[model samples]
Target: MRNHGLVAFVITTAVLVPAAAHYLSAGHDQVVKFATATTSTLELAGAKIEARLEHPLVDPGESLRIKLVASSAVGKRLDVGLLVYGSKGDEDDRVPSPPVGVAHKTVSIAIDAEGNGSIEIAIPLAGAVENRYSPSPFTSYEVLVMAPRAATKLDRLRRNSALIGEGEGIPEYNASASKFMNLYSWRHDLQGEDATLFGEGVVARLDAHTRTINPAIAIETPSTTEVGKVFAVAVTVKNASRKPARGLVLDVETPIGVVDGAEGIEALVMPDNATFDLDAGESRRFQFRVMPDQVGVLGLYARVTCNGDDCDDDSALTKSGTFDATEIVKAQVVDEAPSIVGRK
Candidate 1:
């Protein structure tokens, strides 16, 4: 079956990472110095609240630190609670598996008689072993800060998935946060202490580094080809991990009505579903010759995965987790059978 999700991801990445070559060419030091952290601010009941990540990217098996600061016009101690949840970088927090993974921490800022204070908290990140399964190389987290009373309610809602059934929290918090953010609107839904304690809150995002290995895939094809003539297409898979990638299955999908029937061309080509092994830092290139009978555009899609069902458990090859690579190639098919110039 064709994976439209993979196709969409491939298309979007191609358009978004046009400058990736330049970015990757930089030195390690230059890459490490790149700034990637963000900060957010909100206002509630004459108090200015700010939230930011102390370090946006945490190594695996470490903790993510976030710093929160608030300046209140009212000279009294303010209690604000922060609820944080995480998911794979590509996945949305609305549906977090094993719902208990959510992190909840409450911190109080002592607003002095002058009303100015800030505090920071460290949230422990889950490792592959801790999660009891292999995880993606990157994980993203969302942080929501609200008054202790409102935060407690939201935390319960988030943990139990009560507000929006099971495995969904985005919509519930989105609605609640929107209502609680506005001074005039907070009273409509929230009661006395809850409404009064609730102040302006801020939302923030943080990304954690879980792994270092990153495999890559590339597809090449001519822009135009003859309808009846066999044309060349190439697919390359590279393993960037320190260990070899075993049980690697590469699946290529062609437009309807076209077959891998290379009449006379001679080159190594991958079948519809080809399984192969790639060593560390090595790349494998597979070629294909396609002949189209109609004159129009043809699209070729390719997807590769490691440690899938096709791979056995010999224990020789590293079965760390599943790695995927997807790409699309389009070529215009032209009919070259007409001899109009000579006939005329």
Candidate 2:
């Protein structure tokens, strides 16, 4: 693991062996060429604003920072927030407000008389993903600056823009101001032991084979159970690989009314993830108690991660089990036999 308060940088762009956990200090982007790197941008007449992340490739263990720069013939500013999304379209967690979801960090930028200025924001990796139990790797997040565009009188007021808006006071407003939006993305993967770099256009990827330990899990008992009944189910975790998996974790997702004992083995309650370790060719069974409230079949999911940190790939978080479950039939009482006897 990298120390939480150390300062580091990537000196080269060669293929790097992913490192363990580490931390980085501020002012990490010692060398940044803004205008040269941004091949795309959204700009207003005589002014252009672009947002760029310090590094295109980042370590999952460290925080992600973005620099918003603006240059123009005149001095102007915009209220802005960030939007981060996943490659698989994981949009549950985002920053700022809609269209970016709910986040509280909104900043304003002011350019100098020379028409150049910069403002930045740092997104801590700890809670970057809202409602996520733990972070996942091989996952790329798109970061963009979301600013309110001056579409209408109300929009310009809320956006706090100097630009004019229709129906407010000006006859024609600059609609382009409301439309200025650009997106940039980078991978959250591991790099050399102490540092992670955000390499523009290059994503550091780790496959399952990179992990020394091969792990698997399956339902070993109680393939079927009755609804509204308390039952015990077992899932055996196996290390199919020949090497030991350090800081291993089991990420299990099951429907409601069903619970697992896997909650603690050193666990983080949110997202329902667990952490542990396994040796070469080792197998262990974990028991979970289930109580199905409604009738019908329920689904089960499980995966083994060497630990879903920047150092490991979020492999096999797939459909591991789809066991069957049944519900008890309700019974109804019959009327007294007197009516039936008289009819007979």
Candidate 3:
């Protein structure tokens, strides 16, 4: 997306729709240094509000999720207007083009007592309908073979099974090709416009691309252990998301050598950090009681959170709780391997 006097992000994905890019005529006019760091916070109209992305993760022709929350200090209550824009960066990694331009949806979330809302959307990508970049968005199968007439049902079932051959490459490729959809949000004070901190005339501001909310998790499991040894470790998850994170579950992945202390490997251990809800700036530590069966390096990691059954593309939210993760996106979201960051 381009405008003569307009500035954009140098992002990494492409826009699928030609009409996706357009002019951002917000009238900032003055050349301002918009922060694109993905980790800062912005305050407006007596309300401290923040926008966060669960994961820039998506399939080709899929939507990305963005979280917006607002809260007043103590006494004053405020109502605000929020404008959200999604865009794929240009070929250049520093300057991004226009928004997806696919009819931006309008949603309102009032801020009185830590009000929160979320939106899941697709980031447009520049790719052909049959191009490898967007191939078979529905099938999620690189190869679909139809068998003889009599076995059609069985074959059809097997063909679409995610475990057939590729575990997750289909969605992985699509997410990677698409621009991962970076979020740029602008907040307007409903009652009035405040003076610009940058000095000069006033204007509503898009969130500095750099501001983000993510969890900082610490997994503490023994580095080495013996067979049949009952061991316990704790996962401390801090909500750096700037907003409250609700329906959050602390997911712990046990390596092949270990199993839950109560239930064996396949057992969905209940009441052990499965439910997590935290407001901005809140942290909680939970225990993961486990038994180290056959010994080895039991590499465990605490990641993955969802509001429903599905964990990925269909999951309500997913975030990589890494300080250097930059963006909470699944495109390159490699879970942080458990390590002794410190004794804690």
Candidate 4:
């Protein structure tokens, strides 16, 4: 029997910063600084939101301390809220928290003398627990300080600049690239069945060219099956993109090993054309059969890949979970030699 290579799908989203003008009002003005000695500027609703990071980067579960200073000649008291967004790649929108490992917090700061004072904000990293067994590469996040609605035009300008500016306090965006490896390693409790079995390793770098829109996939199977019987396995694919994808390949892996007649066992490639194009929000399903050789334990994993080459070998972009299998029956052989004894 030929050894079948595992079928794996790798999907990635490439992010691009458009050349469009910044989202700040034209007359607004503000100055923000970073604690790290570097300076960056951002414009929001015509005002600059200045931000600085107390540290260059923080590990998961660690507090990210930020210093924000907003100024506006139209000075007025206003309430502010802070929000964080995460993206798997450039093509993905800045999505909300929880699933994306994003979060939000609020604080009240007064713009003092010189039209500027600092507000210290600490953000706690959530979802650090899930990063253990399943690691996510190409993880990126952005911080935003909201502008107060009741402030005067001048105050709005000052608040916007101060809030979006690229110093120490503003939303400084970063990714887990060469500068950081397995940035979520601090969550040791969830790394694997045991930390020693799967030791800490840097997540594989994702391809920079491919773009991911939703960066998510799901799998499901029948809840019940008898021992030594064959059953159908269903795989569902969701297209989170506005544009249809072409030459897409979906790969499913089973802990019981490759099922006979299943495609892509000899090579990573699927046997049939199996290629599909999916429109935004569209879903499609594929079915395969599994005949357990023995009863004990079973699992199924799935992944979606575009153009064959775009996938992460170690990322949870591939799905996995276990199921129970039992041996309820025993086989026995019977003898038939009674006829000869009767004749004698």
Report the alpha-carbon TM-score of model 1 versus the true structure: 0.43
Per-residue lDDT over 35-145 for candidate 4, one digit per residue giving the tens place of the 0 to 100 score: 122223333333344666544233344555656656652254334545443443322223211223344455665656555545777775433222223322212344545
Candidate 1: count of backbone clashes, pairs at least 3 residues apart or interchain: 1
After the best TM-score superposition of candidate 1, give how far the Cα of residue 47 lies from its true spot, in angstroms.
1.6
TM-score of each: 0.43, 0.31, 0.27, 0.30
RMSD of 3: 25.9
Candidate 2 runs further than 4 Å off: 1-39, 44-46, 87-105, 125-137, 149-344
Please tell me which model should have the higher TM-score, number 1 or number 2: 1
Q: TM-score of model 4 relative to the true fold?
A: 0.30
| Model 3 stretches astray by more than 4 angstroms | 1-215, 257-273, 308-317, 321-344
Error of 4 at 159 (Å): 30
Worst 10 residues of 1 by lDDT: 7-16
Candidate 3 at 242: error in angstroms?
Answer: 2.4
lDDT of 4: 0.37
Off by over 4 Å in 1: 1-35, 88-100, 127-136, 162-304, 307-309, 312-344
Which of the two, 2 or 3, has more lDDT? 2
- What is the Cα root-mean-square deviation between model 4 and the actual structure? 21.6
- The candidate 3 region of ten consecutive residues with least summed lDDT is 137-146
Ranking by TM-score: 1, 2, 4, 3
Per-candidate clashes, comma-separated: 1, 9, 27, 38
TM-score of model 2 relative to the true fold?
A: 0.31
Give residue 154's error in model 4 in angstroms: 47
